[model samples]
Target: MSAFEFVFTFYSLMLGLAAANVGTGFADMWRDRRAIQVGVCAPLLAAIVLVATMNLWLRFWRSWEGVEVGPWALITLVAYALPLVFLSRAMFPGAGSTTSLEDHFFQHRRVMLAALAATPGFSLIWYAAQGTLMPDWPNAWLAIRFFAPLALMALTGRTANRLGLALILVWMLVGLFR
Candidate 1:
């Protein structure tokens, strides 16, 4: 296989696993039938969708004929994928838990948000390193979409969390239209 294919195969696999992990978390939450904090679940679910969407977006790069794929490019891709997996796993505390998903989410909120906050920086670096962030799209969207959550988290209020959730939903909608 070509270097690009070889590297992307692993990248895609990581993203797939990330999506599955998030799906499992959601399934657990649904099956458990407990009160869920919309503030937490909304953005967490949005992050899941965003990660999966990113995997789909990567498909477009597979056809970029002349871009050179090197060892560092592979490394960068892996770096971008790792936090996604961590964030997915963080979303749900564990399997077969009696504790409410909402409680687990509150318990792990800081770690989960830290992982969520790191993903965009890693993604931007990977894309820039790989020359994949198209000039046609203003890079500001990356900052607006990714950092907004971190800013809200830092603000540390119910209003901020609600605003974060709204931002995430809006971001998802914008992604859908793009």
Candidate 2:
């Protein structure tokens, strides 16, 4: 098999497990729905993680197409997927526990956001290692597109509800335009 194929197989497995974790978490929450108090933030964050996982999976094909893969590439790929796994695991409450979604979200938001923030950095590293074609995009644009929402969420704390919604809206708008 080709290097890209072999390497991507490994990456895809990790991504698939991450996706499954999120899906299973949702199922578990539904199973325990009557025992838990549902809230806005945790569900929103779950949606975000689910979508981001899918995006990374889909984007991988286009982004890594025809790329050379080596040991360091494999290492970086594994590193990149680790955060997604962690974030997925964090999306739902633990077993046999009753808690409000908001409480769970607040408890884990920092780690979740940190995991979200790491994806772009890993993508950049992979691109740089492969010397792929992203030089035309400015650093400022990258930072604004990727980091702004995360930073706002990190800094604003509990007061970021409306702001988070606004940011999601803005991100959707940006995606539409792009």
Candidate 3:
């Protein structure tokens, strides 16, 4: 496989790992009783995001490896990418119990579902920034990935999120150096 294939494969795994972390973060928050809503919602959302991201990523990676995007691959690719676009913003931090109730969606459900759906849009940003070229794409994409740091801080709490962001940046730097 080419370096692009290898690097993107690693990046895809990284995204999966990040998604898992998101689930764990929410689970932890829920366990701590800090955000019951996040705890209840985050794990499920994370799984969807992870599955979808992985599916889309595999298709792209296969194509990068010079494989054709066949029917199955195309199906998975679409299944993953489009949902991720809006799902990114789901379960945002600002919504407390007073802000949204489960039944609220029937009347203005889309409006009520805002917080739980923000993350997917950001996921789209991350994916798009990854680009379609080689060598230059992923590396260049890291620069744009910077936008995620603040959101991470907010979602995970400033101190812990900062550390996590720093760690991810460090990992990205190592990949660049490699």
Candidate 4:
């Protein structure tokens, strides 16, 4: 197999696992739909979907040309995928009965936040390591597109979460059109 295919297989596997985990979490939530809090569950669910979608897009955008694939690059890429896995796990309750999805979310809030926070940070490192940080994008668009969600995540209010979700949805819609 080619180097790109070889290296990408591992990355793709992790991404698939992440998506499956998120899907399982959604199923669990649906199973316990009575316990879902729209205020909390909606944003968290949206973020999970966003992460999975973005990871898929990232795989498409990533290329193996003109760059050396070494231990460090592989390590960085794996590290980048780690946060998604963690976030997926965080979103779901353990096996067996649980109080509620909201309760699970509150109990694992820090883990969820840490995992979410790590995604952009690790993504920055992964892109930088691959020498694709700025490619052909305008700096302002990159900053707003990448950093805005992180900034929104810093807020701990319901309004902030709703706004953040709206921003992400709008941004994603624009991307689809483009």
What is candidate 4's local distance difference test score?
A: 0.61
- Between 3 and 4, whose lDDT is larger? 4
* lDDT order of candidates, top first: 2, 1, 4, 3
Q: Specify the highest-TM-score model's number.
A: 2
lDDT of 1 by residue, 42-121 (tens): 34554645644474445436445743578776676666677778877776656666665556655666666666656567
Comparing 2 with 4 on TM-score, the higher-scoring candidate is: 2
Q: What is each predicted model's overall lDDT from 0 to 1? A: 0.62, 0.68, 0.43, 0.61
Per-model tally of clashing residue pairs: 0, 0, 19, 0
By summed lDDT, the worst window of 10 consecutive residues in model 2 runs over 169-178
Q: Over the stretch 1-178, how does candidate 4's per-residue lDDT look in tens digits?
A: 7777777777778877777777777676666666544246544554545554564446445556733568976787667677777777766667665456656555555556556556556666656776878855433334455565567656766566556656655664555444
Off by over 4 Å in 4: 35-61, 67-69, 126-142, 172-178
Clashing pairs in 4: none
lDDT leader: 2
lDDT of 3 at 148: 43
Model 3 lDDT per residue over 77-172, tens place: 344344444444343333344332112222232332332233334445545666633347543444333344334434534344335435544443
Write candidate 2's Cα lDDT for 1-178 as tens digits. Answer: 8777888799889988888887888788777878897677766666666666666666566656655778877787777788878888886778987877778877766676777667766666555776863656443344554575577555646657636845654563454334
TM-score between candidate 1 and the true structure: 0.75
